[model samples]
Structures are given as C-alpha cells and as structure tokens.
Target: MALLTVKNLSVGYHTRKGFLKSVQGVSFSLDQGKSLGLVGESGCGKTTIGMALMGLLPDNASVTDGMILFEDQDLLKMSKKEIRQVRWKKVAMIFQAAMNALNPVHRVSEQISEAILAHDADISEKAAMKQVESLFDLVGIPQDRMRDYPHHYSGGMKQRAIIAMALACHPSLIIADEPTTALDVIVQDQILSAIKDFQNKLKISVIFISHDIAVVADVCDNIGIMFAGQLVEYGRIEEVFDAPMHPYTKSLLASYLTLDKDVVQLNSYIGETFDLINSTTGCRFCERCSVAEATCSLVAPEWVEISPTHKALCYQCK
Candidate 1:
C-alpha cells in the first residue's frame, strides 16, 4: 500500500471577491522508503498541497475537495482530534524556513522533547531527552549544544535542529517544504545529504517540495510538475528528466545547467504571476503556453499517460 495518496485534492482561499482555488485536482502517491519531488514556480500550489496534507492551512484556506490518504486511511475524513494524533507521530513536516520554525526562547533540546512527549505519553522526561540527544546526533548536531536556544545556533544548525524535532517521533512520512531554501549551496548539500541518510536508515517516505529542480532531481525517485494550481506532469525522475513530454517540464529542464554546459535561458512562458481568482474555465496555463491552440482557451485539458509511468495534462500530448 502507498504510504501517502492524495487524490483530486483542491485547496482554496476565501477572498473578498470569492473563493480562489490555489491547488486544483492535485493527485499523487508515495510509497514506503521512497521520495517524491513536488516542483513548480512560486505560487503554483506546491506549498499549499503540503499544508493541506498536514491540515495546516490558514483559517481562510481549506481543502474543499479530495482525499489525503495515509496508509489507506483518509486524513481529510479524520476528526480534528484524530488528525492531531497523526500529525507529529505519523506525518512530520520540515517547514521552509527552519530558523523561523524553531522557537527562539526555548532550548533546542526542549523543543525536540516537546514533540516527542506530545506524541508518546508513556515516554518520560528522561527518555524524551535521550531521544532528543539521539536525534541531534543523527542529524550531526553536537551534543554539547543541545541546551542552546535557537538564537545560539547558526543557520545550518538551526535547520538541523528543526529536522531533529521533526524526526523525534520517527514518523512514517516526512514532508520537507524547501528545507534548504535560504542556505548556501554547500549547506544545502549537507542538509539534503543528511535527510537522505536519515530516510535510508529509517526506511521513511519523503515528499520533498522545492522550486529548485536540480535539488529535487538529485534526491527524488519520482517527480511531479505543477503549474498554476494543477499537476502538469508526473513520472519516474529519470524518465521525466531524460525525456520530458510536457512543454512546462521541458522548459524547466532546459533551465538547469548540467556538467560542462553553458547556462541556457529559461523559457518564460508564464507572465509575472497567474491569477487564480479570475481563473474559472479553460486551461489555467493557456495564456502562458507557447503551443496553446484555440481549443486550449475553450476547455480544460485532461491528464493522459504518454508512457508506462509518465503522464501529462495537455491536449498536444494526447
């Protein structure tokens, strides 16, 4: 069974004018000990999907349609109390900004212990502390700095601390939403390597969300491309990168710089930003698509499989 399955997931925000859908019909599944990368430009609903899965959407935002199933159990259908039980213990999340995610006032160890205690009531203070230390060690954080507050740690250290907190409960799935965004290239490599090591050791599934296609390409087994609140393409990482069928996917891969290759100008098909509120009919990417036809402006595209494991949502592909 899949560790996580999101089907027909749609998220919307209540605005002054009306409800504006941010994530429309986003669907995918992750298996145990596997990683799936969610890649898209900013405002393409990558983060929204992550938040919806964790039930962390803002008050105005909600999952209007779809099911988030973890191990065949529908998370959307679970009660608030039941969802609470699953949050840290079964599904943990590493926020985009790890520094901001950590509490400035509390010591690092304390924060990690709190997460552990919240999930496992039988775990005493001493056991939680031991687990926190073990997590610190696992994430390559020094034991001596366990009592230090968030402010005392460097940017990378703070990120490692956040990762430690997330792993305190030994979750089955970890959703890392741009976990290495603000860090430098070297630190980003270190953090990602650490995450991979932990995933392998624990046999945990990961949903890695990032706009950095290069980063995702390195770590994920599968890739799902999103554009204007919809999944445009999905397939095995090698297949998607090696022979991308979707125009958007092709454009994204072209933007990356490979070994000994000069940087290529990224195809900017989309304008400044996509207006999800005004979008009601037709293909959401019609205005930006270079290969769009009159039919694209008149109707939404359907997802069709082009290969055994590859699928795309485009009339041209069909």
Candidate 2:
C-alpha cells in the first residue's frame, strides 16, 4: 500500500473580502522510501498543500474538501489531539525560512530535545541530548555548537539544523518546503545531498516542495507540477523532464538553461498569471498556456494517462 495518499483535497483561505480557494481537487500518492517533488510558480498552492498535510494551516485557512490518508489514517478526520500525536512521530516538516522557524531565544539543543521528548517520553534528558548530538553530526553540523542560538548559524547551517530537528523524531514522512531557498548553490547541493543520504539511511518518504524545477528534478523520483491551485501533470521525473506533455511543464523546462544550450534565450516564453479569485470552470492555465485552444476556455480538462504512471490534465492530450 502507498505510504501516503491525498485525494480530492481542496483548501481555501478566508480573507476580509471573501473566501479564496487555493488548492482544488489535488490528488497524489507516495510509496515508502520514495520522494515526490511538488513544483510550481509562487501562489500555486504548493506551500498550502504542505501545510495542510502537516496539519499546520493558518486559522484563516481550512480544508474545505477532500481527504489526506497517511498510512490508511484519514488526517482530515483526526482531532487536534490525535493529529498532535501523529505529527512529529509519524509525519514531520522542515519548513521554509529555517532561520525564522528556529526560535531565537532558545538554544538549538533545547529545540531539538523538545522534539525528541515529545515523541518519546521515556527518553532521559542525557539520552535526548546525545540523540541531538548524533542528529547534528548526521546533518554535517558540529555537535559542540548545539548550545548556540539560531542567529549563530549561517543560512546553510540553520537549514541543516532544521533538518536535524525534523529527523529528531525519526518520522516516516518528511515534508520539506523550499528548504534550500536563498542559499548558495554549493550549500544547496550539500543540504540536498544530506537530505537524500538521511532518507536513504532511514528509509523515509519525502514530499519536497520547491519552485526550482532543476533542484526538484535532481532529488525527486516523481514530479507533480501545480498551476493555479491544480495539478497540471504528474509522472516519473525522467519522463516529465524529457517529454513534458503539459504546456506549463514544457514552459518550465524551456525556461531552464541546460549545459547543451550554453546561451539559451527565452524569447518564446509566455508571460501571464492566472487570477485565482475568479472562479473559472475551464482550464486554469488557459490564459497562460501557449497551446490553449478555444475548447480550453470552455471545458475543464480531465486527467488522462499518457504512459504508465504518467498523467496530464489537458484536453489536447486526451
């Protein structure tokens, strides 16, 4: 059975003006010890989906519809107490902006120990400290620096520390939302490598959310592209990267500069953004899609399987 399955999941935020739908009818599954990449432009509901899965959505936001099934348990139906138990023990998250996520007032060791204690009550303080030290070592941070505050660490080290905290509970699933953002390429690679190494060693599943298609393409086994609160395409990473059927996916790949194309220019790329507040019954990408036809504006596309385990939501593909 799949480790995590999210079906017909819809989420929205309540604004002063009105309710704004952010994620609509999104569905996907991940198997044990596998990684799925969630990629999209900003405001496409990538972070919202991550927050929903972690049960950390803001007060203004709620799961308006759908189910999040993790190991056969429905997360949407679980109570706050039940969800609390499930979190960190079964599922953990490494949030975006690691610097802000870490507490400025507390020592890093205290923060990590808190996570460990929450998951395993029987663990002694000394034992938890030892485990925290091990985690720091695992994530390539110096063990002696655990007493330092969040401000003491560099951007990359802070990210590493966040990863360490996420792994403190040894959860089965880790949802990392843009964990390498704003870091140097070298530091990003190191963080990615460390994450992959830990995932391999611990046999953990991951949902890595990022706007950087290149980074996601490198780490994920499967890729799911989101556009305007909906999944446009999902398939094996290689298949999606090599032969993207969706116009949005193709555009994303085209925007990237590869080694083969040393002086790549994006003169043909479309520049349009979808208005999320306007409820559109038709294809969300129709406004921005280069290949959009008249039918795209009239009828919503159904997801059609193009190859084994590959699906695209486009009338043209159907």
Candidate 3:
C-alpha cells in the first residue's frame, strides 16, 4: 500500500479580495522508501501542499476540500491533539529558511533533543541527545558541532541540522519544503546527496517540494509538476521528463539548463499568470500554455492518462 496518499486535496486562503485557492485538487501518492517531488514556480502552492501535509498551514489558510491519507488514515479528519501526536512522531517537515527555523538562542543539541523528547516523553534527555548525535552523523554533520548554536554553524550545516531534526523521531514521512534554497551550488549538491542517501538507507518516504525541476529530478523517484495550484503532470521522473505531456511541464524543462539536451529556444513563460481568486472553471495554465487553443480557455482540462504511470492535466497536449 502507499505510505501516503493525497486525494484531491484543496487549500485556500482568505484574502482581502476573495478566497485564493492555493492548492486545487492536488492528488498523488508516495510509497515507502520512495520520494515524490512537487515542482513548480513560486506562489503555485508547492509549499502550501507540504504545509498542509504537516498540519502547519497558517491561520488564514484553510483546507476547503479533499482528504490527506497517511497510511490509510485520514489526517484531515484527525483532531488537533490527534494530529499533533502524528506530526513529529509519524510525519515531520524540513521547512524552508533553515536558518530562521532554528532558534538562535538554543544549542543545536538542545533543540533537536527537545524535539525528540517532546514526541517520546519516556525517553530521557541523555537518550534523546544520543539519537540527535546519530542523526547529526547520518546527515554528515560533525558531532562536536552539536554543542554549538545555530549561529555557529554554516549555512549548509544549518540545513543539515534541520534535516537531522526532521529525522530525529524516525518519522515514516518527511516533507521537505525548498530545503536547498539560498545555498551555494556545492552545498546544494551536498544537501541533495545527503537527503537521497539517508532516504534510501532508512527506507523513508519523502515529499520534496522545490521550484527547480533539475533539483527535484535529482532527488526524487517520481515527479509532480505543479502550476497554479494543481499538478500539471505526474509520473516516474524519467517517464515524465522524457515524454512530457503537459505544455507547462515541457516549458519548465525547456527553461531548465541540462547538459544532455540540445540547446533549444528557451521558453521564458513571462507575462501575467492565471487569476487564482476569480477564475474557477477554465484551465488556469491556458493563458501561459504554448499549445493552448480556443477550447482550452473555454473548458477546464482534466487529467489524461498518457501511460499507466504517466498523466497530464491538459487535453491539447494529450
């Protein structure tokens, strides 16, 4: 069975103008020990999906429809206390802005140890610290640095610490939201490698959220290309990338620089984006889509299966 299954999960925020649909009918599944990447442009609700899965959505945001099923249990139906128990114990998140996530005042060891103790109350501080040490080692951080503060650590180390915290409780699922943002290229590669290595070694299911298509493809087994708060295409990374069926997905790849592909006209999808607040019927990506026709703007596109494992939310492309 799938470790985590999100069925038509929709999220909206109450804005001054109207309710903004941040995520609309987003559905996908992650198997044990596998990784699923949610890739899209900023403000497309990639992070919102991750936040929803973690039950950490802001007060203004609300889940309007759909269910979040983790291990066949509906997380959306859980009470606050029930979900709190599930949060760090079963599912954890490595939030964006690693530096800000850490407490500058607390020692790295204290913060992670506190997290472990918060979940497993029976575990002593000493034992929790031991687990933190192991996690630090697992994420390739030196153990001596555990005693230091977040400010003492470098940017890469800070990210590693955040990853370590996410894994401290041995959660079944980890939702990583833009974990590689604002890091040097070398550090970014290292962080990606660490996430992948531990994911394979520990048999952990991961939902990696990123705007970078190349980065997502690097660490994820399956990929979901999101746009305007919906998944445009989804399948095995190779299948989706090699045989892209969504115009937005193709545009994302075309915008990405890859050595294997020949130099092609870069499709810079510049211009006005789809209106999230008002339009609810037509396909949101139609305005920016390269192959969109008159019918695309008039009728909403539905998921068209191109293969058993591959699908696209576009009729024209299919």
Candidate 4:
C-alpha cells in the first residue's frame, strides 16, 4: 500500500473579502522510500498543501473536503489528540524557516533531545543525548557543536539541525517545506545531498515542497505541478521535465534558466493573478494559458492520461 494518499483535498482561508479557496481537489500518493515534489509559483497554494498535510494550518484556514490517508488510516477522520500522537512518532515536518523554528535560547542538543524524550518517555536523558549526537553525525554536524545555541550555527547548519530533529523519532515520513530556502547555492546542494543520502539510508518517504523547479528536480522521484490551487500536472521527474503536457508546466521550464541552454531565453506568463475569492467555473489558468481556446474559458479540463503513470489537466490532451 502507498505510505501516504491524499484524495480530493480542498482547503481554504477565511479572509475579510471572503473564503479564499487555496487548494482545490488536489490528490497524490507516495510509496515508502520514495519522494514527491510539489512545485509551483508563489500564492499557488503549494505551502498551504504542505501545511494541510502536516495538520498545521492556521486558525483562518481549514480542510473543506478530502481525505488524507497515511498507512491506510484516515488522518482527516482522526481526532486532534489522535493526530498529535501520530505526528512526530509516525510523521514529522522540517519547516521552511529552520532558524525561526529552532529555539533561539536553547542549545541545539537540548532541543533535539527534548523531541526524543517527549515521544519516548522511557528513554533516559543520556540515551536521548546519544541519539542526538548520532543524528548530528548523520547530518554531518560535528558532535561537539551540538551544545551550541541556534544563533551559533550558520544557515546551512541550522537547516541540518532541523533535519536531525525531524529524524529524532525515526518517523516513516517527512514533509520538508523549502528546507533549503534562503541558503547559498553551495549550501543548498550540500543540504539536498545530505537529505538524499539520509532518505536512502533510512528508507523514508518524503514530501519535498519547493517553488524552485530545479531544486525539486534534483531530489524528487515524482513531480506534481500546482497552479491556482490545483494540481495541473503530475508524472515522473524525467517525464514531466522532458515532455510537459500542461502549458503551465511548460512555462515553468521555459522560465528556468539552465546552464546547458546556449541561448538566453526568458519567458513570463502574461495575465492577471489567480482569482481565489471569486473563482471561475472553468479552468483556473484559462486567462493566462497561451494555448487556451474559447472552450477553456467555458469548461474545466479533466485529467488526461499521457502514459499509465503520467497525466495532465488539459482539454487539448484529452
């Protein structure tokens, strides 16, 4: 069975204007030891999806409809207390801002050890400290530096520390929301490499969320492209990157400036921002889609299969 399955998940935020639908009917599945990347432009509901999966949505937001099944159990159906019991022990999150997430006053070792002790009460402090030290080793942080406060570590090191804390309970799944964001290219590469190696070694599943298509391409096995609060395309990394069926996906790749491209090419999507408060009945990208026709404005597109495992929401594909 798939380790995690999210079906027909819709989420919205309550704003002064109205209830703004952020994520609409999004669905995907991830098997054990595999990684799925959620990529899209900002305000496309990418982070909202991650927050929903982690059950960390704000007071103004809610899951309007859907099922989040983790290990065949319905997470959406579970009580808050039940979900809390499952959170760090079964699944953990490496939040977007590691520095902000870490306690500024506490030493890194204490913070990680506290997570370990909170989940496993029987584990002695010495044993928990040992586990923290081991995690420090795994993430390539020196053991002696574990006693340092969050302010003592660099951006990359803080990220690694957050990764280590996420692995404290040895959870089966990890939701990494822009874990490498705001870091230099070299530091980003290092963190990605470390996470990749750790995932392989531990055989853990991951939901890697990022706006950077290149970063997602580097770490994910499968790619799900989101736009205007919907999943527009999904397929294997190579398939989606090499032969993107959705116009939005194509535009994303076109906008990305890769080193191999001999000619300098920059492309931008031309249209109004996505309408969430007063959403249209037709395709959300209809206004911006370069190839959209009259029918695209009148009717929504269904998922059209390109291969057994690849599909895109486009009437032209159908």
Tens digit of per-residue lDDT, candidate 2, span 62-119: 8988999999999999999999999988999987755688989999999999999987
Tens-place lDDT digits, model 1, residues 77-110: 9999999999989999998755678888888899
User: lDDT of candidate 2 vs native?
Assistant: 0.91
- On lDDT, the leading prediction is 4
Score candidate 3 by lDDT: 0.89
Best model per TM-score: 4
Candidate 2: the clashing residue pairs are none
Q: Candidate 4 — what's its lDDT? A: 0.92
lDDT of 4 at 207: 93
Runs of candidate 3 with Cα error greater than 4 angstroms are: 260-265
- TM-score of each candidate? 0.97, 0.97, 0.97, 0.98
- As for candidate 4, its clashing pairs are none
What lDDT is reached at residue 184 by model 2? 90
Indicate the residue-level lDDT of 311 in model 1. 96
Count clashing residue pairs in model 2.
Answer: 0
Off by over 4 Å in 2: 267-272
Clashes of each: 0, 0, 0, 0
| Tens digits of lDDT, candidate 4, 31-125 | 99999999988899988988887787899998999999999998888889888878888899988755688989899999999999988979999
Deviating ranges (above 4 Å) for candidate 1: 264-266
Task: Give lDDT tens digits, candidate 3, residues 1-318.
Answer: 999989999999999999999899999988999999999988999989988888888999999999999989999899999999999889998877556889989999999999899888799889888899889888989999999999998999999999999999899999998999878899999999999988988899999999888889899999999998999899999999898889888888778887888876776776687788987588888778777788888888988998889999999865
